[model samples]
Structure formats: C-alpha cells, structure tokens
Target chain A: MAVTAEEILATYEELSEIEAQFDDVETDIIRHQYNLSKDLYVKREKIVSKIEHFWPLVFEQAPMDIDEFIQPSDSQIILGALKSIDVKRFEIDTPVEGGDPRSVSIRFEFNENEYFENKVLEKKFWWRHGKDGFVGYVSEPVDIKWKAGKDLTNGLLSLAKAAWEEEQTASKKEGKEKKELTPKQKELKEKLDAEAATGAESFFCFFGFIGERVSAEENIEALKKEAEDRKKRQAGEKVEDDDEEMKEDEDDEDWEDEEDLDIFPQGDTIAMAIADDLWPNALKYFTQAQESDDLSDDEDDEDEEGDEEEEDGDKPSKKHKACAHGCKH
Target chain B: MAVTAEEILATYEELSEIEAQFDDVETDIIRHQYNLSKDLYVKREKIVSKIEHFWPLVFEQAPMDIDEFIQPSDSQIILGALKSIDVKRFEIDTPVEGGDPRSVSIRFEFNENEYFENKVLEKKFWWRHGKDGFVGYVSEPVDIKWKAGKDLTNGLLSLAKAAWEEEQTASKKEGKEKKELTPKQKELKEKLDAEAATGAESFFCFFGFIGERVSAEENIEALKKEAEDRKKRQAGEKVEDDDEEMKEDEDDEDWEDEEDLDIFPQGDTIAMAIADDLWPNALKYFTQAQESDDLSDDEDDEDEEGDEEEEDGDKPSKKHKACAHGCKH
Candidate 1:
C-alpha cells in the first residue's frame, strides 16, 4: 500500500521521540564509561611515564586519521622534544549545570624545543548540542607561543587568529552584520584562504582549532530556542516565519561549507581521533612501532641493539635513528 | 632513551591486562544498552507494521555497507513481498553458560512470494572470542528452503551446504584431515569457486554465511589453552614446540585467506550493519526515503498524491513507482 505524506510525517515525529530517548541513554552510558575509565587512565599514565620515547613512538604509529595531519617538520619537533601526552574527560565530575561529561581535554607536554615557549599546552573541547540538531565537540582557538621562525603552521595560525579576533570584534560592534576587512586585513585573509585551500597545515595547527564558528553559550541558547519551537509545533501550534526558517537553514548550510574550507576542516574528527582512538590505544600503537621496527631491522640486517646504547646517550641520535628507519622525522 | 625489546614486551603484557579490563567494561555497557533498547524496539516494530512500504523504503535507503551486497534481483524480491524485518539479541536472556548478550538474530518476514517456502527466514550470528585474540560474530549456514526454480542464490547455497556437510562427515571420520571431494562434488565446487571469484552474489546468499572456518567450541578451547600457555611463559616457564606453533599460525593464516574468498566474505560486517546500524536507524532511513521522494517529486513535477490511490489498490504499481525514482527495484 502507498503511504501518505501525513502518515510518514507522523511516523517521523514518533521516531524522533524514540531517538531522543536513545540519545539520553547514550549520554548516560558515556558519562558512566567516562567515570570508569578515569582511574584506569591514571594507572596507565604511571606505567607509561617511565617508558622512554613512549609519546613519540605512539604518535609515529598513530592511525591515519590523526597521522595525516602530522607533517615531517611536526614529526621532527615531536620526536625531538615531545615528552608526554594525556587525555581526560575534564567535565565528567563537574558539578556545574549543563556540563557535558563527554567534553575532553588533550594535554601535550614538551621539553625545551625550538618550536614554542610553552612547556605544557592543553586544548579543551566542549561537547554541546548544535542548533542544527546535531551533537558535537566545539573548541576555542588556542594560541601557541611559537618562537621566531619556528611556527610549524607557516604563519597560517597567526593569520587565522587575527581574522577570528576581527570577526569577534565586529560581531560585538554590530550584531549579526558582516564586517568589511581593511586592506592589510583583506590581504592576510586572502593569503590565509589560499593556504587553507592547499590543506597541508601542520599538526600544530590543531592548537588553533575553533570548531563550529560559534561560541558555546550562543550555541546552547540557539539549541534551547529550537527545542522550545519544536515543542510548540508538537503541541499543534502553528509556527509562523516559514520563509525565515528556510533562509536560516540556507545560511547555516553556507556556514558549514565555509567551515569545511578551513585549515583544519575536520577539527572535530581529528579531536575525536586523538581523544578516543589515539589516546586510549597508545599502548597498542607503541607495541606496533616496536613490531614494525623489529621487522625493518630484520629486513635491513641492522644491529639495532648496538645502536641502542648510542641512542640513550645522545638525544639527536635518537631522532636520527628514527629517521633512518623511514620515520617522517 | 632507547627502549629495549624486553621492556617493549613487558609493556605490551601490562597493556593487554588493561585492555582486557576495558573490554569487560565495554561488554557490560553493551548488555545494559541492549536491555534498554529491547522495549523500544518492540514499540518500533508495532508502529512500523502498520505503515505501508515501510520495510522496502527503509531498505532502499540503507547505507552502502549493507546496500552493496543487495543485487537488483534481490531488490525486486524485497519490494515485492518483504513484509517486515526484526532484529533481536536472542542470547541476551539465555540461561546457558557462555551465552553472549551481543549475539543477534535478524528475522525477515515475507508475504506469499515466489522465492521461498518459509514465511519467515531468521539468521543468527554468535558473538565469540576468536583464538586469534580478536572478538567477532560467527554464524552457521542457514537453509533458505527456496521453492524449485525460484532460488535467488542460483544453486550456490545448495552446493555450499553439500560441501559443508561432506567436510563435517570427513572431519568426524578423520580428525583435522583434509577432506577429498568426489568427482561430481569437485565440479560443483569449481562452479561455486568461479561464482565467488566474480564477487557478485544475491543478498540471499547471506543465509549461507559461515564466518570462521573453525567451530566456536574449538576456538574457545584453543583460546583457553593459549591463555594458560601465556601465563606459564610469563612465569619464566619455557613452552616447547615452537616450530609446531609457527606451523599452526601459518595454517590459520591460510584458512583466513580461504574464508575471504567466500561469497559473503564480509558476513560479520554485514551482520553488524544490519543489527547495529540498519535496524536501529530504520526510522532515519525511512525519513530519508520520504525526503528524497519529495525532492524527486518536485523535480519531476509529478502528482504523486494522485497516483497514491492507485498504488494502494495495486501492489505492483508501488514497485513501479519506486523504480521510477531511480531505485534499483
């Protein structure tokens, strides 16, 4: 039998209610799992800290989702000065209302390196419900204090940061109005756009990630309004402004397209890969590195054991040894 | 500092213990989610049974993972007589020991159709821990009992079943010995192998899925013995028969390669897509179908509403209507 449009729409509304329940249960599961993993992660950190070259090796064997962003220069910096990495669901125990337990913070500690001044850099992602009826993690732009001529992002981060600041300033001055850029700003923006088109930014540019192009507070408010509107519609109330709603949807789609052209277009995906896959499976990655190294050693007929003592003595040799084995470093 | 091979090996052992703990937690989470979804799924089935063309429309919008296996002929059968589909975690509430809560059974109910004798065809997949240290679902070949000259699998299933029965008989008589096929059996086997090489089979061949070459009982016993051996090795006890173990590993690899050459090589993946993704997300797929249909109606400038009454009266027109919109049917 042919299904009427009305029946389809009604069924969709019913399904949406069921989906919402499923989503709630999923959130609860995540919150519980996050709490359970906390102590285990702490135990893991203690065991991993004493292991030499742990972080570098883990990064080297990271899955393609995360590895694709790491440039040779980025690998050099990582192999040379990257000390350790930590991931935590920072909001899991938060007592604050509206806090999402799934929001995570990824911390990278580095030794004295040529890249940046900061010894510890932490990037926090806030899991929020989007206005477009999707849930994802959003993050603010993190400023990395790069040393002179040591920016692995090739000045793209600085350019993006400036443009973001200008956008923020303009938004504050004139709500929801597009701001015209000055000549210098326009030139910098053009250069940034061109660099973004190439899509070969360093992994360090992950620090400059600003997902969603909107603040958390603004997103939460918009989602709340949308929810209220949905409830009103469900209660058999006619929602006016259909044309305005269509225009808003089109605008949102355009913004999403623009977001896709950013340097770190898949920032959320990368963040998820790091937080979910790379961090939890670090030990597996480390083991994989060891296994691959062993295979290559056998193939090359190299005395890697004899070189181990030299690697322990000189830090530079460790980098060289990794590079000799076809590592990006 | 350079990590020694001993240290890497020791770390891997420690990490494996941590991973096992994580797995336990994951299993518990899945059990809880499964129980919670049971009632919701029941409610969904009740609602869906009243909707016309529900199963066909949902299948039409299925993701590529599942859709890729479905042939045009399979689509015709589905759109013609498929009444409803149901997925259940059959082993979840089983009182038997070693019952896995994750094991699922997918049931497809059909109206009086030209394909098969049975009104309902159910395929069950058992979630098990493999001897190779990976956990996956395994299923036995399900008999479709197709009507004469109406077999969708083109006699492939029948040939496979006969070959499997012969293997079983041979194994019973001469434990682990290679089975020899009869001259007539060899011809059928050659035809089956050729069909498998083409990598084009009816979706009905999913009923003939036997995921792992080894029986579940054998796998479980092997895993238990391996675990015991690992414990002994960790305690500095030398286990002999290194060459035998290497040979067994090679044999297992060969078996895996042979399994990959089957008609439904990705049976586990397809089963997962059905149970986890397609079944749970049926409402989403149905909505997608309706939305896509609306878009096509607008593009074609056709009065789908005027034709709806005719579709309600005639079953074949529903298939024609779907085909008109570029569906495989």
Candidate 2:
C-alpha cells in the first residue's frame, strides 16, 4: 500500500518537534560547559603569566643547555615534556557574524623529537573552543619511522615506537582494499590530499624568518587557509559519495567518541608544566627564601653538594651540577 | 607584574589554533555518524512499513478491544504497548522556501495507566525525528491521584502511587531554596513554566476531537509554539544566571550524550508493538493458515474452550472469554 501524503506530513511535524527540543537543550548544555571552561582558563592564565615572568631568568642563570630542557628524553619519571614552539595559525569557522565558532583550533607540534622512537607528534595543532579563546588539545601521536641511524635514548619511547613501526609495515604489506573510482574523481581526491599534506608541512617551517617567528600577517593568512581548507574537506566528504577519506582521522573520531563537551582544551602549558614538574623545586625555593630572612641556616645543602662535586673535577657535567645546586641562583 | 597586550593576543591565538583543529576533526566525526544513522533509519523504516500494512487489519478482526491493546496494564509479560494513535500534523519551521524544518515531532502517549503508583503515563506524545518524517518515542508515565474512591486493580500500581503521593506532600511542605531574582524575571520564568506544564497536560486530549483526531493545522501550530517556547527557555537559563533550570531535562541530555550522530529516533510503533507483544500470535496465525490448507483439524484448544464457556450461561466475563478464544481473529 502506498503511504499517504498526510502520514508523511504528520511524521515530519513530530520529528521537527523532537529536533527543536534536543537542539535547544544541547545548545544550552554546551554553552554552560564553555563558560565553566572559560572561568577555569582565566584562573590558569594567572599562574602561567607568573611562570613566564621567571622562566627566562631561570634559563639564563641555570648551568643547563636549552636543548636538554626541550629534548624528548626521559627525566627519570614521566614520558617527556611536550611543548608548543609556536602558534602557527588559528581561525574561527562560522558563517554567521558573532555566532560562536563551533570549530576553533590552534596548530603546533614538537619542534624536536630526537628521543622518540615509534611515533612523532603530528605537526598539526589540535584545538577546541574555550570560554576566553581557543584552547589546545593533544591530537593522537602519528606513527613514524626514525630518520635512518637515529639513536633511541628513551626505553618506553623505543618500545612503543618499535611496536607501532611493526604494525605500520605489516599493514603496508597487506595494503588497502582497492575501490574503483573514475580517473577524474581519483585525481581530484589525490589533489586534495596532497594539498592538505603540503599545508601541514609548510605551516611551520622554522628557517623561513631566519630564526624569528613568522610575522603576524603571515600567521593570519595561514589561519584563513586552514579554515578554508577544512571547509573544503567537509564539502568533499559530502560529495565524494565514495569511501577514500572515510578511513582518514579514525583515531581523532575515536577520541571524540570517548570524550564529552566538557573536555575543553586547557591551553596554558606553563601552568601545566609547573603543576607537572616544577612544583617541588618551586616550593623548596620559596621555603628557603623565607627562612633566609630570619636566619642564614644550613639551607644551602644543594650549594654545598655542588661545591663538593666541583672539587671532584669536570666529571660532574653542567646538568649534574645544576641538579646538585637546585638550579637556584 | 602586568600581562602585556601582545602576550595576551599570542595566547589567545595559540588557543584558537588548538580549538580549530579539534573542532574540524569532531565535525567530521559527527557528520560521519549522522550518515550511518540515516542509513539505519531507512532500513528500519522499510521493515516497519510492511508491519504497518497488516497490523490494522489484525486489530480490527481480533477479539481484543482497542482499550486492551493500548492500556498500561500488565497481561502476562512486558510493559504495556504504547503506540501512536495517529500522525496528526507536520510543518517545516524554516521560512526559506523548501528548506527542511529544523523541528518535527509526533505526539503520542499511553491511553490509560491505572496500574502505575508513583507516576502515571501523562497523555503526551513524545516524538523523535525520522528520516522521512516523525517517530514517536515512549514517554515515562506521569504521576496522578486516582479519583478519591477509584478501585485499584494492579497491586504494583497501588504500592507505587501511595509512595509517590507521600513524597509529593513532603516536598510541598519543605518549600524550595530561595534565589534572588528581579520581579520581572521571576514572573517571566513562572509564565514559561506554567505554559510548559499546561502544554504537557492538554497536548493529548483525545476526547477534544470528538472521536476524530486533532487537525493537522493545530498540530503544526502547536509544534511551532513548542519550538518557540524551548528557545525562550534556553534564553531564560542564560539570563536567570541561576541554577534553577540546571536540573531540568537531564534525561534528554544523558540520552544525547549516550547517542552519537548516528542516533536517529525510530518512529514506527507498529514495528515496535509487533516485536514486543504480537509475535507469538502472529506466528501461530501464519502456521495455522498453512495447516488448514492440508487438513481441517480442530487444533485451537482455546477456541473450543471459548465455545463451551459461552454455552454455560454467561459465566466467563468478556476479558476471560477473550483470553479463552486466544483473542485471535
């Protein structure tokens, strides 16, 4: 039996009502979450500003090289420090003026990964909208091969890298199942992929500005392109009617499935670093500074240790000496 | 120390970049999920349409009353069958010509529920968006007081009703936590809540149509109003700056959180009912129809029992007689 037009109309009306209900509720929930995250970001920013004030002074005075601080090596505890060398670009992708961009992001990746074995953090910056501005989220680390003959120094990184490399090779040998596409469609898809790959690479070339960061104008242009390219990709997904790009970004999708709207990016790395690795030393420094005001006691245990190590000769390297002296001036 | 304007801009830009990256990836994931859900909805709809073809015929001829089919009373197993009485109306909310409506919902609820204790199934049709139109979802029963002297038939309902009534009285006595709000805001909130409550109550007055269903125009207008009301409430939540509405529609939020873009509301009650309660009888009917072709055997023991009971001078009541006959057509 043929379905009546009336039945179709009735069904449509009901569906609209439901959609209205859900959209209204969801929008409110997301906005509320955003506001909460924003408030948190402000609190975090204050701590970060204080760290920024002191970090340069500490780096200048401490008997340790900049390379040691930035290297992706084990420090006897956590995996390693992940740093954002620079904000290569950013943009809000929304057509409506003043409408909050549902999609906001920043792009940055590890500038050096000499210690990493199995994977490299992708050069692409992952981001999410936060209350004050955009916040950075960690994208899944991309699998990679070591530059031939590069030595691995971190045990955990070596193990994970080897496993990932093995998986990659096996998968490559098995190959993707081929689907027949018209030459024109295949060419267009290849073009789009190549453009995206090229964009990702040139997005943060370090030598272009002769050791200085890219100018603000260049950064803004890059941000615009990133937004435009993403828009194009979305359009492509809808049009391709094919399945090539379907397999791309599966990890990112899985991550999204596991997370909720409340999972905003916490963009203050200085605050994160202070919490993660610097708190103990910072507390010790403050305690000593306060005690020294009342009386000069035997609070210079680290300095004494450094002096003893120095008497034992050049065997105690700068890093060891810095550690012994508590890297405090 | 003070934060420089440049430093703030740099931080904001970095944050924006990270957010952009995440938003792009998430949007792609959600769109993919939506496409998958749409496909599933289409497949489910085909199966439902086939079931719809035969159900009305069976219900017309079968020895069960419409009331028996729709009532919220337990028979042998399972919750009572809640169904769509009709797809009463539909309209696109968008003003743009031929633009699909953002809101469409079917109205339906359980016809009766004397068995529920703490809650009763309110006569409100909960709806979901369907691929081609609208689908009805089962709403939980509402709470009600029985007319002062109504007899309770179901033991479970009686127990629940008493407990719910007690809770209501206690809460009413306790009073709500006071919040400071402008008199105008307070009045507006009260107006909105009262409107929503009233809409919930009369949304499904079956007798108002005088045995016929409500007109499509009325349903369309009602849907428009519901959509408008929801939008206003969301605005209210933002303005009220209070937590009063924070607890509202938590279930809907949980449902949204649980479901992905691939989640579409399945709208066919005929399909739901057949799967739930009618399968055994339907199978038996098909099997008997096949057997009667080969031989005329008095295989229906229940039908024979029904004949005997009828001859015994009105001893078996209507319900018992129906049960004896297997309620078969």
Candidate 3:
C-alpha cells in the first residue's frame, strides 16, 4: 500500500517528537559535563597559583636551583597518595632583563576514583625546567564524590541511541510500505539520519574532547602518507595492489574524521547545539562537508589552507597538563 | 567567633553548587514548555487555514454574511468534545480593493487533560466576520499526550525549594556559630539569598506567562493610584489616613511585580538562561534596574516614554485574544 504525503508528514512529525524527547536527557548530561569541566579549571588554577607562590618563599634562605629543588620524590611526602596525573610544561617566552629564558614542568594528580568519576582529591605538583622533586597544592570547589564524565557520556549515549533507533525504525517502515517515497519523505528520512548521526557524534565529540583533535591530526597524517603512495604508484614505482586496497580503507576512516572535525570545528557541547535548535544549522554543515568530498580534487589545497590557519595562531586546542615534580620519563 | 572571608567564599560556592544541580531538571521542564508552545502555534495555524477554505464554497449559492454563518453552536457540533479553550480574533489589516476590512473569530479546544497537561486531541473552529455558523478543522503536528506545564513547574519548584533550604540551613548554621560576620561574608549571604529568590521567581514567571504580564500591568495601575493619594496629601486635600495605610500594602506588592518584570523582561525560560551561564548577566540587569529605581523620581516621564514605545509598536510581547461566537457573556 502506498502511503499518502500527509502520512509521510505525520511520520516526519512522529520522528521529530522522538528526537525531542531526548532533548531533556541530553541537556542534563551536558550540564553535568559542564560542571565537571568548570571544577577542573578552578582546581587547576588554584594549584598553579600555589606552586608559583611556594617556589619563591622556600628558596629565600637556601640558594638552590629552582629546577633541581622541585622534584617528584622531594614532594612525595607533600603529595601523599598518588592519583592520575596530567603533566604540562611551560616556557618563559621572553627573559626578564635579557636573562636566559627558563621553562617549568607541572604535574596534577586527581584521586583515582575521584578524577575518573568523582570530584574529590585533586593535587598539583610543580618542578621547574625538569620533571622531578615536587611541591603540591590542594584546590577548592571540591565535592565528596559525583558522577564522572564517562558515566554522563554513557547516559547520554543511551538516550541518544534510543532516539536514533526509534527514528530509524519509523523511517524504514515508511520506506518499506511505499515502494517509492515522496520527495518530502525522502528529505525527512535524510534529516532524521543527520539528526541521529549528529546526536551520537555530539556525545562522542564532547566526552572524547582531547582525543578528537588528536584523531583528526592522526587522520591527516595518514592521508598524507596515502597521497605519497598514490604519487609513487603514478610514478611507475612497483607498489603492491594490496597496498592500494589498504589505502582505500584508510581513506574511508579519514573521511569520517574529516566530517567529525568539520561538524564541530570549535568542539562545543552537542547538547548546547541541540538546545539552541541548531539541528538545521548542523545539517547545513554536513551538507557543506559532503559537497567538499565530492570536490575532493581540491583536498590538497584545503589541507594547505588549514596549515596556514594553524600558523596564524590557531592551535588545535588548549591542552590541560598534569604537573608532576621531578620524575623525568 | 566571626566567619572569615574564606569561609564566606566557601559558603557561596556551596550555594552555587546546590543551584547548579537543579540545572538538569530545569532544562527538562523548559524543553517540555517549548514543545507545548510549538504545538499551540502549529494547531492554531492549521485550524485557521481550514476554516478559511470551508467557508467560501459551502454557502456560495445562499451568499450569507460570513459573520452570521459562524455560530458557537454550529462549531460546537463540528468541534464536538470540548476540553479547554483558547479564543482568538483575526482582523484583515488592509481592506482589499477599498472594500470593508473583515474579521473572524476563532475558538481552539483541546482535551481537558490535553490542554493543561496532555498534548492530545486539539481541534479548532472559526466564524467569519458575519458569524451565522461555525466550521472546524483538526490541526497538524498532533500527539497523543504530553506532560503538562503545571507538572513541570511543580517538579522544578520542588527541587529549587530543596536547594534553597539546604543552602539557607548551611548559611544559618555558619551565622549562628560565628556571631559576627565579615563584610565579605555579608556579601556572600546576600548573593545566596538573591540566587534562591531568583530561582523561585524563574519557575513562577515561566508558569504564570501572560498572567505575570497582566499582574505587572495591574501593579502599575495600583502604583499610579497610590501616587495620586500622596499628591492629594501634599496638596492638603481631604485624604483618609486609613486609605493611605492600605495603599502602602499595595505599593509593596507592586514593587515585587515591578522587579520580576524588570529581571526577566522577555519572560524567557529561566532554565535556558542558566544553561547559557546568564546568571551573572541577569545579576548585572538586576543591579542596573536597582539603579534605575533609585533615579525613578521622574517615573511619570518614564511611563510616558514607555507609552510612546508601545504606540510605535515596541510592545515586547505578543498578545492572544479571547474569541466569542454565539455565546453571550
């Protein structure tokens, strides 16, 4: 039996309602993520400030090298029970009075369970110019324990997946009933897929924050290698045909990364995007990326343009580093 | 024992955390509200279009006046099961070809549960400029049912009140322990109180919607009456002292409405405001409003300016009307 266009519209409406139901859950999870992120920031800043202050006072009476004095082992008593760590290094961009520019390394330890799933026990240790002996600070805005990013992400993904499945089932039923779908129905189906895809991607992108940029960079590196192989093949080098097939697989994965990066270049929480009624806006982005894929002949130039932007102070993202005093790897 | 500034800051942070936990529930409630508002808009449009089409062809031979044909009883049969009603009147702003510009009256009905809480069974009826009879149309974007605004509000208010109580108890305990409070502690206490007040106000403002605006208008009217009495007293006119005392009670109530209207002048979903990190922004608005109130000796001129803005079509809100067909008052 052929379904009427009106029926298609109804199906579209039903699909939207399903998606909208997830809006609440998605928003909740995002809020949780935001709170955690904010806590991390405050904790980091407080510890960093303390380390800065602790350095000058301790060295006032004893003339010791700032770099050597701050070691992980030296601060082992101060740091107490160790937790997960994020290490960071900073350089003095310009030396005061033309003195040689110096650098420092810092280590941040969060309570294993707390850092991973709860908001408790965050410690920061700092070592200047070397990774060793450390001094620590305890930060504020603390809590006993709360749900971690992973837990929130899992919850978000569950709701999002359910929404996607509901929409997909409705869309599939419409397609099976009607041998040929109306243009509007076809459009609706495409939009439902986009919404679902973006919904899932949002969770993945948000929770996997630092990982996403790293993956995109990795994808580009793989693409560059693949391009080199193609050039070698064209130059009549004896490259195995099996190598070409592997390259093709890598190409598909690269496209996924590219689409992910393009969809959320700035890496904003997907929950916020959905809350702002931005599905249509996100669809527009997907459309642009799809068009760009069709015009892949210009890929090299596009990569070159991205490189230029990076050179113009467009860093991939701000990385949160764990400062550990004195234990050089 | 006096509470130190550090202790005060800790209290403030705790209060914020309490409110932040409500963010998820509030967002859920707001999303529900958005869905209801969207449904209302869609249903109204569908019914109006149906009535417009139904009128012309059915009475072409008799050629009766449109207003005369549309009656409440006629639409009553077509609309059948009445649930709840929202009435509206539409006027042709411009007369076509210099003829008399006509108007129409429309009545919307939803299932009683549907209207307030459920999102089911919405039907619309309308009578032309000449209401002799009425015709009906079932609207689009239909759903079986949904959670009502009242339930959402009640749930929100419950959580908000809990958060408020917890913070209040904490603050009081600290105050009791420390007989004297530092200036910073005083400021923190004030801010926590403000957050609690705003949180409660947000839920009330959202649920009250149009009623809030009406209340604000009513407050202004009362304020004007109180001012008139004050002027009479200054002029040595015979004004009853008891009347002046009664007016003071009304004056305080009016001030509350005035503050509410000022704080959320747009009547936006408070949940969204918080999610967007707009609490600080809203606080800034409150401060500015307080300053304005202090400089409000020239309030009459401000009212006149507001009237001019309204005349210039600067009314910030869209107004809905009550439509009456064959029913007498």
Question: Which of candidates 2 and 3 reaches a greater TM-score?
Answer: 2
**What does the lDDT read for residue A297 in candidate 3?**
50
Which candidate gets the maximum DockQ versus the true structure? 1
lDDT (Cα, tens digit) per residue for candidate 1, span B1-329: 68787665566455555655665676787788888777888878877787788899989888877889899989998998899998888777673345567788999999998888889989888876554433567777677778889888888777766656665665577554443554434655577777767766899888877766546685567557556755765675543424335456645333223453354656777888888778877866775576567656664655665345322321110121122212221
Distance from true location, Cα of B323 in model 1, Å: 25
Candidate 2, B242-285: lDDT as tens digits? 22233342222221211111111111233233322233133222
DockQ of each: 0.13, 0.01, 0.01
Cα error, candidate 1, residue A52 (Å): 4.5
Give stretches of model 3 more than 4 Å off: A1-251, A255-267, A270-329, B1-329
Model 1 CAPRI quality? incorrect
Using lDDT, give the best candidate's number.
1
Q: Which 10 consecutive positions of candidate 2 chain B have the poorest summed lDDT?
A: B315-324
State the weakest 10-residue window (summed lDDT) of model 3 chain B.
B320-329
Question: Higher-lDDT candidate among 1 and 2?
Answer: 1
Candidate 3 lDDT, tens digit per residue, A51-160? Answer: 22222222221112122233343233223423322322122322232111111222334334321343223221111110111011111111122245533233333332
What's the C-alpha lDDT at position B279 in model 2? 32
**TM-score of candidate 3 chain B vs. the reference:** 0.19
Clash count of each predicted structure: 0, 44, 39
